[model samples]
Target: MPSILLISDIHGNFPALQAICTQHPPEQFAHICNTGDCTVYAPYPNQTLDWLRTYQAISIRGNTDDKIIRLLKGQTFKKPGKKEKRIMYTSTAESLTSENSAYLLHLKKKQVLKLGSYSLGLFHGSPADHEEFLFDNTPEKRFQEIASTCKYDIIVTGHSHTPYHKIISGIHFINPGSVGRMFDGNPAASYAVLTIDEQARQKIQVQHFRCHYNTEEVVNELSRMKLPEIYGIMFKQGKKLN
Candidate 1:
């Protein structure tokens, strides 16, 4: 079986990121792909970048990645409320190296791959837009429409910070979810492994997985940065802080 790892939306949670890396033998997987958001939301943006860089991710730019890159390149930002803007700006200061910033800047919006009979398209959001997040809460008809627009047997994406799988229009759409934030009623860091064969051409195995980390580490780091304390609770609760 040809194997690939799908990771996404790692918003600078170092503990979660490191746990996931240790769960696997790097040589076992043929490739690792990410759907961006490699930084933001918590502390350790630079550390997370270093981890991904060490792994040599085949990455697609998520909205957060794009936004950060723009901000780092001296563009203006307006997301995350006024307080968050200040916090994010302060935290990311000196976090992005010139080369890493440029790497995020040049991340592809989409990726297409062909191996024997299998067809794959990878995007951070939807096929039409990198910022479009495909998620479990989305409408079924909308998924049908999105799947139809793409001419591939399998589509991979991330952004909702949740991991899920859908079969539509003879197409398999997969979201490995967020590696950093599961602030959606599940605290475990989530990802997926996809195994498929081109000659068999008809089978795809998607394994949605979650791994726990020392939430306090991330929380403490965030607290140290004066980021929203709720982020700490969110990591502990596995969802948005109540």
Candidate 2:
């Protein structure tokens, strides 16, 4: 049997990331894959990127990650509607260390991994669009279309911040959910353990897990960092603070 740990949307909340790492050490799995959104809206993007680089996790560039990179390259999100998010991206981009920024700069937008007989496709969102979200309620026809086009047995994604596993058109679609942010009214860190049994007819199994962390601690830290109050409210309520 071989296992891979799937994680995503670690929006710079080091504490929540720490909780997941503590519970499911990366070494325990054959490989660790991060779908994306490794930075933004949290206080420790540098620490988060450092951890991923240290573990050599297979990572893809998420939408927010792209935003940070662009911001570093003198791009600005000056649109009136993006004021809060612009602050987040600018601050996060400025906080990155040179080493970590370089690390983030080299990440691919998508990756395909071959684990023995199984092939896995990793993306921050849907295969076609890095920011497109595929949820449980996404039309079956859409998934069928993706299955027809995507060339992997298992497709892993992030960005929705919601954990789910669905098999459509004989393809396994898995989202490990958000390690740093949860939008489902639960303030715990979320991740998934995917196991492949070589000998079993049903070869793939995914276990979604949530580890409890101190949400208020992150909330307080956000205050110290002078980020928007909505982020703290989102952490406290475990949902979008719109």
Candidate 3:
């Protein structure tokens, strides 16, 4: 059996990422897989990317990552009311080191990993769309539609910042939820552990873990950066503040 540590939506909170990694080191798992959205909405984008690079995490680009890439290419979000977002994305892009920027630029939108005797499909969202949200409450018909089209035995996705494990038509879908931000009403950082055993009748086991990190530290860092206070509040509250 191989133990895989699954994480996603880090969003630049180095302290939270560090706490999770400290609790569950990459070396302890068969693989440390990140579902992306690694940057944005917090401080320490560079540190977050550096940590991912150091661990050589299996990662794919998410929607916010795409925004950073586009910002690097001189394409700014021109929407009238998104000044804060524009600033946030631009600042994150500007903070990226050359190596990290190149890493983001070359990332594939999706990846397929062959683990043990099973194949896992990894995506920021669903296999067909990078920005789609497949949450726990997503209609069964939609999931069935995806399962019918998906070729992999297990489908791993992020971008919803919500965690869930579902089996539909003999296919396993797992989302480890958010590492930096939690939108499920609980503020604790989230990750998932997956074990696959070919000999067992059950074959697979998925568990979600929540590790509490220092949210005050993240809030202080955000304040030091002079970014929007809404993000700090979100960090404190574990959900998007409207």
Pairs of colliding residues, candidate 2: none
The model with the greater lDDT, 1 or 2, is 2
Worst 10 residues of 1 by lDDT: 84-93
- Tens digit of per-residue lDDT, candidate 3, span 121-229: 9999898799899999999888899999989999999999889999998899999999999986777899999999999998999999999999999999888989888
- List the global CA lDDT of all models: 0.79, 0.89, 0.89
Model 2 lDDT tens row, 86-151 = 788888888889998888888899999998887999999898888899887888898999999988
Q: Residue 75 deviation, candidate 2, in Å?
A: 2.0
Q: Would you estimate the TM-scores of all the predictions?
A: 0.91, 0.96, 0.96
Any idea what lDDT model 3 has? 0.89
Flag regions of model 1 displaced more than 4 Å. Answer: 199-202
Quality of model 1 by C-alpha lDDT: 0.79
lDDT of 1 at 209: 85
Query: Candidate 1 on 1-242: residue-level lDDT in tens?
Result: 77888888888887888888788655578888887788877788888888778878787777777777677777766676667455665467457887677777788888888855878888888898777767787888998888777799888888777678889888998999888888677777888999886456657888988888888898888777667776787788888643
